[model samples]
Target: MFAGAGSNLSQQFNLPFWVGTFGCAMLTILVSFMDFKKITRVLGIFTPIIIVMIFIICAYTFVGKTYDYEALDTVAQTIKSPMPNVFLAVINYYSLCAISAVSMAFVLGGSVVRIGVAEKGGLVGGTVIGLIITCATVTLFANIDNVKDADIPMLQIVKNISPVFSFVYSLTIFALIFNTAFSLFYAFAKRFAGRNKKKLRTVLCISVTIGFCLSFCGFKNLVALMYPILGYIGMLLLAVLLITWIKEKKNILAENLIRKKMIHLAVKKYDEDLDYTKKDKALFHRLGEKSVVDTEEIKSEIKNFVKETGTENLKPSEPESQSQSSDSANN
Candidate 1:
């Protein structure tokens, strides 16, 4: 992204490409030192700006431009895609995306107050990303002939609409690229350095320097070479996560079954003495739903309830025949 952003700026402004690259590296280093909350706030502000820009560009091209489905088909055949197949391309793209998502997930997971919040965040984030990708793909195919050979096709599309719009969009694109680089690099450095501030700074500097040197490999070429490889690694990560989740779910289901049986048995054992109501049963059912439950602890709790309520001395009512015999003897 750094390489692509810098390449675009250099082309648009007629400046040295290396200058833009160096600037991104310096900005990344400075931004990396700031608190994560500050960085998140900045990204939060730009996210809406990006969404609006993308929508305007897509809507404009679709409304104003001529639709050449025949030309699009021909271009699709003529152009050589980076991936061999569409399925592989999608997987590679998502895998590469998962790297950033996972990185931020780790960082932000700590601040989450509830599992529901995290789940909601993932849902909304995934939906937004899907919409953006779908719109971009539609726009690209809608104007395939025009952007087929362009390095940064989105910018080309915007530039056709207006140079001023192109310039503003370029700044937005740069901030987004910076956001990605800063997140990945910061996460890497934090992981390696742990809680050591001095070491983290050193790691960040070294990583950014190395990344800057690599940006000379031309944005397109680097993406073509690196993204798929990362995607494969990301697939492995995803597989591992899926397997772990399945195992955990199985364990949870087993625990729930055991808890249900235990609660039923405890309730039945004292049914004659203790008056267990619908509310009490609901409470016991809830205890079974927790992540962890101890049968022994539950038994002790039931015993304590019996003692506290004076149910321990309570006995089952005598049969009618026994009661009648006692009454006759007394008479």
Candidate 2:
């Protein structure tokens, strides 16, 4: 979060930019060495911490008096962006996030998506989550005058509640960063590690070293630069996905039609062959001797009749035995 390759320990006196980044990278390396079962248990810690942090922040803000009630009221009337801009932004943001979540689960490597959250049918909860965050953000807007120029506005807001609360927030941020780094780098290393435990450490070390050097570019600048590019790329990806889905559906429908036609033709052919056998045998019996009687010439007539009238319904049936009677022998 600090602008440099690492945290600015001299200025912040806590987690400097470089130290925090490197720390996360180190934790990621540690996680790569761990077996999957251990990783699941490790992930279980993130939810509780996030829940507690959000509840704490929400509770404090709800109880505290707004610094400027007028600014809070004005936020309701303010137009942050044009309606089209907002619609596209929301669509692009959530779709990209969903894709990233899927990709990460895939990269974790295995049949099971270990870190994936199984979604329930309803999405009403997502609306509630948004409302809660937005309400707090609106409240913060009332005090934006105080933090408009600060490096971390939330820190300033939390510190105002209590220094103790600020420290707790700090620790929460640390845990979140470490968890993110661990998941990402573990996935990255796993791809190249390829079941070679001996080479994993070396690969992880190389990844960390490269990342540590990149930290000098500054996190804030990198985020500012990448976001617009990523958004455009995400939109393009969504378009491609939609087109592919449409093509697949069309192909499936065409295949189904072809299959049905083939099945109908096969059934009709079977009926024609059965009718011809019946006619030929009857002619043979008429002469009172076994003889070849061809009925193939009438095949087209049977087919035309079937086409106009349609076939009978098919069902499973048992064979019925026929007994030769004295009347049949005379014929």
Candidate 3:
């Protein structure tokens, strides 16, 4: 999207940026609902090829066009002035917010997986945290007036701190872009894999190649073309996600209630008898109702209990009893 924005802004506030950004954003969301592992593997294989293509294009563009520092300065000056149309400014601002929010949602999704927090509260909390971080970062660094002229506004700020820091910042940016591209490729591959490794490879290679080719029309021009488009698409997706969440709230709550009840019932069953049949134990195991359980310790105790008392006589025990059994077994 940033690439698209840069592209569009370079071309005189045209439609291309909006189109590209929104299109890519929609594609990202569509790809995300897919199986991730397959997508990732395919991306892993295709990324090097894509990068090579992008490098070639960059080389070509750098040689073909004169560096337009003066034009860049003019653009910066134009953006510094008040936007002629108040409505357009409002729309642009809202679009920026939507893009930020959607990006936050993706970050939240990744963090939840990493931290093993898949609950509703976890999703909400992660999203909130992501938004806070994004907003704070933008507030700290985004100088709207100078943003128009800067090739890489955020990176420029880092350079001001130190050249070494700027170089590191550039590395980070490269890593992030590569990571996101690979992740996107992986997502697409998973969705379309269908047990055909050859087909998956082909599709991923093609997509990355296309993206790489597109990237070299000039990064800033591409970004200018993409961001507004993405912003609009993000706004739509946000509405849908919000509506779905609202509609499912009651059902989600009810499911959690059922899970809590099942946990309570399993704990009760453990109290009723010192010995439980394998089937009875399996019932509690299948319930897997652990909003907060020390699963590692539980697994260790279960393993020892199976080895010592045998699986046939294994019983669900209270948390304290479970701890005691584990300690005794270890001793």
Candidate 4:
């Protein structure tokens, strides 16, 4: 899956090295949504065995070679003969770097999830980080000449250390690869199933077969070409995310301002209406006091009419009658 996709991406992007890496990553994500439980089970059982095999092969090959044997001797000589502590140191260093990388990835994943960008950012960040670490480690420590010539530098490193260490290292590598492959396979399966069940089986078989064929090209060369391209793609995605977030923030701010203005207008209108009603009531009471008909009596009549008829009755058009009564009183 990785190789075919990587090659395709490389050709498409005109970046044979990094684009291919990005393609492999995309393929992995595409596969992760499939049968997770089954994939996990397979990986759990297969990883250790693969690692052991890798370690043994690497160890035997490196140790059997006269140059590598001399290289180990040279390393030993440089370090003033092999010490038990040296082996421990090497293991500790490997363990530290591996653990740190995994821990950082988890932290980054959690952060992206918190920011609501888990689907977009988390995958990109994780892939870029993974590629960076892989490439850096291979370039830095893996014997340059041997790495180019040999199938696996890590296996050689293991062989240089000891058969047991080599086995352990191989196991670790196998586990990592298995986990990655399974994740990709599962994603692809899930995606295919959701889209079309009838075609799912066919898609899975073809994808896996293609990926397996690509894997034979060896892991190191693939990583060398794929990592940088992925990093660049990741940067582009990050820029897009930032722009989107900014736009969303602006929209939210505008909406909030509109909401606030609406609320203020509603409250102001309500207050004005309340004041108007109060003034009208006071005027009504004053007019009632000066009139022949009591205000309370008029109100009682209106209420009674409303109760009987199930409708509001006016107090009667008394404006003209009140004016005439006042004039007559004046005369």
User: What lDDT is reached at residue 26 by model 3?
Assistant: 46
* Tens digits of per-residue lDDT for model 4, 18-89: 454444554455445456445555655754455345444444544645455556445444432122465654
Each prediction's TM-score versus the true structure:
0.74, 0.57, 0.49, 0.36
In angstroms, the error of model 1 at 207 is 0.6
The reply for model 2, stretches above 4 Å from the true place, is 1-15, 64-92, 107-136, 139-142, 192-202, 238-331
Residue 267 lDDT (model 1): 43
Between candidates 1 and 4, name the one with more favorable lDDT: 1
lDDT of 2 by residue, 1-331 (tens): 2233144231235555567666666666777677865786677586566666666666677675545577755653453332246567666565554444444455432322111222221144356546555655654665566655444556667778787767766666666656655555555666788668768678877877776667668765655565445666777776876798587776545433332322233233556433334533453334322212123423333344345455554211322101112222343
Clashes in each model (backbone N, CA, C under 3 Å)? 0, 8, 29, 18
Q: Quote the RMSD, in angstroms, for model 2.
A: 18.2
Q: How accurate locally, in lDDT, is each candidate?
A: 0.73, 0.52, 0.48, 0.45
Candidate 2, residue 274: Cα displacement in angstroms equals 48
How good is model 4 by TM-score?
A: 0.36
Badly placed stretches (over 4 Å) of model 1 are: 64-66, 249-331
Candidate closest to the true structure, highest lDDT: 1
- What 10-residue stretch in candidate 4 is worst by lDDT? 259-268
lDDT for model 2, please: 0.52
Which candidate number maximizes TM-score?
1
TM-score of 2: 0.57
Stretches > 4 Å off in candidate 4: 1-139, 142-148, 195-201, 216-231, 245-331
